[model samples]
Target: MYIPLFDIDGTLLKGGGGNQAHKNGGSYAFRTVYGLDDKACWDNIITDGKIDKQIILEVVEKNGISHKKALAKLDEAIDATTSYYLEHSNEGTCIAADGAIELLEELQKQNVPLGLLTGNIEAIGIDKLSKAGLAKYFEFGAFGNLALRRVDLIEIARERAIKLVGLQMTTSKFMIIGDSTLDVKCAKDGNIPVIGVSTAKSSSQELAEAGADLVVESLLQKDDIVKFILD
Candidate 1:
C-alpha cells in the first residue's frame, strides 16, 4: 500500500483562520509560562509549520529569557502552548477545511495507509483533529512534540508507518501532503514526493515554486488526487 502522510493544521483544519488565534494563544503561553511579552521577540519569527520548542526557544532568545531558564521551563511552556491551542480548537475557532472530510474519507476507501505528519505536538495535533472529528481518519502520526525538526519527524513517520501499518517499501513510495514550503522541503530531504494543497497560507504558485510534485488549490477532487498518487 502507498503511504500518505497528512499535515493537520492547514492541510486538514483551518486553525484560527490562518494563525491569528494560534499566534495569540502562543503569545499567551509565552507570557504565562516564560514571561515573554516583548512584542519585538515575536516580530521576526514565523511560527506556522514550526516545531513547538523551536518557537519557544526563538521567543526565549528574542525576549532575553535567559537560555538556561528557558531550557528549565521548556516542558511547562510547551504544555501551556498546547493547552491554549486545545482550548481554542475546542472553542470552535478551528474547523475542518473545505473538502477535507470528503478527501480523507475517499482516501480511506482506497485503503491507503494514512498517518499524520504535523508540526503540532502529538497531543496538540491529534487534539485538533479529534476536536474536528477527523481524528478517526488517522491511525498514527509523528508529532512535533517528539522531534524538534520536521525532517526528523518525517523519518519518525516512516518508521511508525512501517511498524504499525506494515509499510514495507522504500521511503520513495511514501508521499507527504501539506500546505507549506517547510513540508515540501522536508519531503525533499527524505527523497519523498510532496503534494501541496493550498488550504494554508501558501498559494498554489508558491507551493509550486517550492518544488511540490503536484499543487492543488484544495482537496476537492478525490478521484483525481487518488489516481495520480496511486499511479
Candidate 2:
C-alpha cells in the first residue's frame, strides 16, 4: 500500500490560512508570548512554509528578545494560537475543498496509509481536522511545530508511517498532496512525487511548472487518483 501524506490548508480546505484573521492571531501569539511585537517581526514569522519554532527564533533575534526567553514562552504562544484558531473558526471554517472529502474517503476505503504533513502547528492542525469532522481519516501526521523545513517533516512522516502501519515504505511509493510550489519542492527535495491540487490559489499550470508529478484541478476528479497512489 502507498502512503499519502497530506497538507491541510490549501490542499484540504478552502481559505484555511493566509487570511487576515489567522495572520493577526499568529502575530498576536508572538506578542503575547515573547512580547516581541513589531510589524517586521511578525512578517518574518509566518512566511510561506515556515514552522512555529523557526518563527519564534527569527522573531527573537530580529526583535532583540533573549533566545532563552523565547524558548520558554514557545508553548504559551502555541497554546494561544490554538485558542485563536478554534475560536475564530466558528464563523465559517473548514469548507472542505471540492472533492477533498470524496478523495480522502476513497483513499480510506482502500486502506491507504493516510497521514498529514502540514505547516499548521499540532494543536491547530488537530483542531482544524477535528472541527471539520475529518480527523478520523488521518492516522498520524507531521506538523509544523515538529520541524522547520517541510522536507524534514516528510522524512518524519515516513518514519512514523513505517511504524504506524508496518509498511516497508519507500520514496517511490510515497506521495505528497498539496497546492503550492513549496509543497512540490518539499516532496521533490525528499525524492518523492507530489500530487498537486489547484483548488487553492495556485493554478494547475503553475503546479505543473513547479514539477508536480500530477496536477489535478481538484481531488474530485473522476480520474482514478488511486492509480497515482498504487500503480
Candidate 3:
C-alpha cells in the first residue's frame, strides 16, 4: 500500500511547465487585465512559491473573473485542451522530463502503486501525461480546477486512489513528489511524505525550507532518486 502520488510539473515533467500552451494562453487574460506577465510576477504572485490565499486571489484577478467563474472556465479549458491534445498527439509538442519514463518503468516493475495529484486541471493534466506516454502510470488523479484549493484535490485523489486499489491507504502509504512549495504544502496538509525535485521554479534549498522530506536536483539521477525513494 505504498501509494506514491506524483506531481507532473517540475517533479516528473520539466521545463516551461507542462501544458504551457494552456497556461500561457490563459495567463494572457490576466496579463491583459493587469500587465503582469513578468516572470517575477508569475513566480511570486500566481504560484506564491507556496500555496496560500494570496495566490488564490492573484489567480482570480489575473483571469479577470471571479474565483467561482474562473473555476468554471478552468474546467472548460481543461476539457477542451485534453480533447485537442489527445486527438493530435505525436506532433512532438508534448515532452517528458529526462529519465521520467525510465523511473516510472522501474517503479511499475516493483509493483509500487502510482497516482497523480497535480494543480493542473483535468484536460490539461491528462493531455500532458497522455502525450508524454506517462498517463498509464497513474491509477487516478485529482485536478486543480476541480476545486479552489490544492488541499481539496488531495481528498479527491485519496478517494480515487482508494477506489482504484480497492483498499484504504494511510498517509504513511502516501508520498507526493513535486517541485514547488505548493506541492510541499499540499502533501504536508494531507499528512504525507513529499519528494521534492528542483526541476521547476523552486530550488532544493527552497523545497527543503518548505518541508520536503527529500529534495533531489534532478530525476536524471535515476540511481540516487530510486535509492532515496525506495530506501
Candidate 4:
C-alpha cells in the first residue's frame, strides 16, 4: 500500500512555530511601509494603533528608494524571521513528537512508500527533514510555496509520487497526517483521508470538526499511527 503524506510544522517537528511565526508583524510592515530600520519602525508600530499611509508616503518620498525595494525587504524580513525560528528551534535535529520518526520508520520497513506535504517552502522543509536525517524516508513530497491553498498542492504531491516512484496509488490509498484543521480540509478537498495528530496547536476535537477521518492525540503507543493508515 502507498504510505501516508505528512505535514512538517506542528506535525513532525515540534516547536517550529507555525503560521503565527510567518506572518509579517505590524512592526515589520511598518518598517517596510516607512523605509525605517527594524528598531525605530517597530517602536512606532507597537505604540501606534494604526499605521498611517502618510508615514509610508513620507518615507518613500524622502528616501527615494524604489517601492519594489521596500517590498522586497519586507519579504526578506519574513523569510529571515522564519529562518531564525527554524534555527533556534533546532529543526535540524528533527526533535519530532514521540514516536513520530519511529512510526515513519516502521512504515518504511513495511515497504510502504511515503511522501511529504508541507506548508513550508521547499528549501526550509527539505533542510529540516535532511538535518533530521528523515529526508530519505520520503522519496516524493510537495511544499507550500506551490500555491496559496494546501489543496492545490496536495494534488501536486499525488501526481509527483505517482510519476517519480512509478506507484499507481489513487486518492483512496492516499492519506494525510497533520495537526491542524487545514490539514483535514486540504485532504478532504483532495478526496483523501486525513489523520489528525493532536500534538500541536489544533486539538483532536478541532480536527474532527474540520473533518478528520481519524484523530490521534499522540502516536507514541505501539502500532497506533501504523494501524491508522493500514486499518
Candidate with best TM-score = 1
Would you give me the overall lDDT of model 4? 0.65
Write down the TM-score of every candidate.
0.87, 0.84, 0.76, 0.70
Q: Which candidate ranks first by lDDT, i.e. highest?
A: 1
lDDT of each: 0.78, 0.75, 0.68, 0.65
lDDT for position 122 in model 1? 70
lDDT tens digits by residue: candidate 3, 1-231: 356778876676665534556545444433443344534345544552332233434665564557665444444444444454444444436668888999889888877777887766566677778777889888788776566678777778778877877748655676788888888988898787888888877888999999998888877777766665676
Q: Give the TM-score of candidate 1.
A: 0.87
Which sections of candidate 3 miss by over 4 Å?
24-45, 48-57, 62-92, 228-231
* Candidates, ranked, lDDT: 1, 2, 3, 4
How much is the lDDT of residue 136 in candidate 4?
72
For lDDT, candidate 2 versus 4, the one ahead is 2
Winner on TM-score between 1 and 4 is 1
- Superior by TM-score: candidate 1 or candidate 2: 1
Where does model 1 exceed 4 Å of error? 15-25, 38-41, 66-69, 87-89
Error in Å for residue 5 of model 3: 0.7
Per-model C-alpha RMSD? 2.4, 2.9, 4.6, 7.8
